[model samples]
Target: MAAGTATTAPTPEPAGRRLLRGKSWLATVPLLLFFLIGFGLPAVAIVTGAFTVSSDAETGAGSFTTANVTDSVQGAYWTALLSSIKLSALTALIGTAVGVPIAQAVLTSRFRMLREAVLTASGVLANFGGLPLAFAFVATLGNAGELTKLFHLTDHGWSLYSFTGLTVAYLYFLVPLMVLTITPALEGLRVQWREAAQNNRATGLQYWRHVALPILFPSLLGGFVLLFGSAFAAYATAAAMVGATVPLISRQIADALSGNVLVGQGNLALALSLDMIIVAVLVMAVYLPLQRRSARWLS
Candidate 1:
């Protein structure tokens, strides 16, 4: 009300509010420390070890170089990396193909309980991977197993240890994961769009081909890449089912890190881990944009 003075903004915020803000930030300290200990430290070790020479005399601070990285991707390791990529790409595509329809059906269902049941099942099956899943598959389809005996699979010649078999096993979990992810995206597909297409004399197939598929494409592709990363990083099931015969990069990384091999194995393993990290980063980079776009509709 003073002529020459201007009103203050209530001291911006009270001391108590400032203190609460500090406390809120302070609450994250434990989580930050946990991340530093659990992830940060390991990441540092991997990065350093990837570039650090194995036999340096400095002990604590070894000589740094990129020699390990170059060696990590050569010879057998290169083959393994390619193999892993192939396996992941194939399985992810297959999973998307299998999962999209199921998700769409769930999204379009009239019954809420049926939708809930399917989603609940998908969630359970998605996490039902690893060694246990492999073992179950083997028990049902392995040589002299129940299915092998009942269906006389030996006469039909279905070997469960091969690449095709591993793919089938991977599909068991991957499909359900796709179902869960794509369901939300499918739900984002508006009935209005379909009705509009129908109003314009478009058939269901034409609607999907022209409008629905285009809208859903980015989300579908992103899900495929997510599945790829999931399958790429998986170890326990692949290790249990196919072992070293599969020529997977994850298995090789484990072998290098297991301390059972050459002196430079640690550096090799770290380099491999760094490569995997880079790949996952690239995948996520593509995914983030598509995610933002897809989220626009859902939001």
Candidate 2:
């Protein structure tokens, strides 16, 4: 059409490059299979079972029903779920408050040994929970525990099996978890930002309030979401420590599965599990967006 006009043609991809790209997907085959077998199948089963009821108890034949889900949200089950949410929220908040300062301290420390030591301890402790953690607290704070007897804490109406005590137990690991989570975000803060604030006649508190906190807010909230999920799903520690005394969703699920309180309530267990899955999905929905924002700033 035009004598002087130059048109660019797209380069064709080589056959070998196309073949290599096809082969690259093969590497993910194992992981895909593992996920399907491990998570996907179980998730499908839970959802399906939550909506089914037995047509014949002996033969285990089932029919679709919404009764399981409806039952899961009433009476004791509802109370247990609320208790779990409250406990998780409380521990997550306290853990975040405690952890941020400790993380900042570890990040600002001049001594490498101290930093390494704290980090190593945090790594170990954050992964420490369940029966052993329960026993540890019971031994240290129970009615007849050493410190309890020594300080006569029981006389002051302190009980290790109560909500307050469970909170203390949760904070043990949750705080360390927060420290591990928020440390990298703390490290992402540049010295230049602090210097700029100083050059502007900003005090340390002013710098943190305006510059650092704004930047770290996403990470902090993400860390809170993590702690909330951890505490929410925790079963073993609460089961071992408080038993039926403190009604928890996890405990209720366990009881439903084991038929401890009723016979043939397996579908109810699945329903409870579905509730947990919904909560976890909501938590991820919040966490993922915050993580993306934090990565943009920190990375």
TM-score (all chains, Cα) for each model: 0.86, 0.92
Q: Lowest lDDT 10-mer window, candidate 2?
A: 286-295
Clashes of each: 0, 0
lDDT by residue for model 2 over 150-247, one digit each (tens)? 99999999999999999999999999999999999999998999999999999999999999998898899999999999999999999999998988
Off by over 4 Å in 1: 1-38, 56-61
RMSD of each: 4.2, 3.3
Q: How big is the positional error of residue 73 in model 1, measured in Å on the Cα after superposition?
A: 1.0
Cα lDDT, all candidates: 0.88, 0.94
Per TM-score, the best of the predicted structures is 2
| Cα error, candidate 2, residue 55 (Å) | 0.7
Candidate 1 TM-score, true structure as reference:
0.86
Q: Give the per-residue lDDT of model 1 (tens digit) for 136-250.
A: 9889988867999999998986888888888999999999999988887787888899899999999999999999887788889888998999999999999998887788889
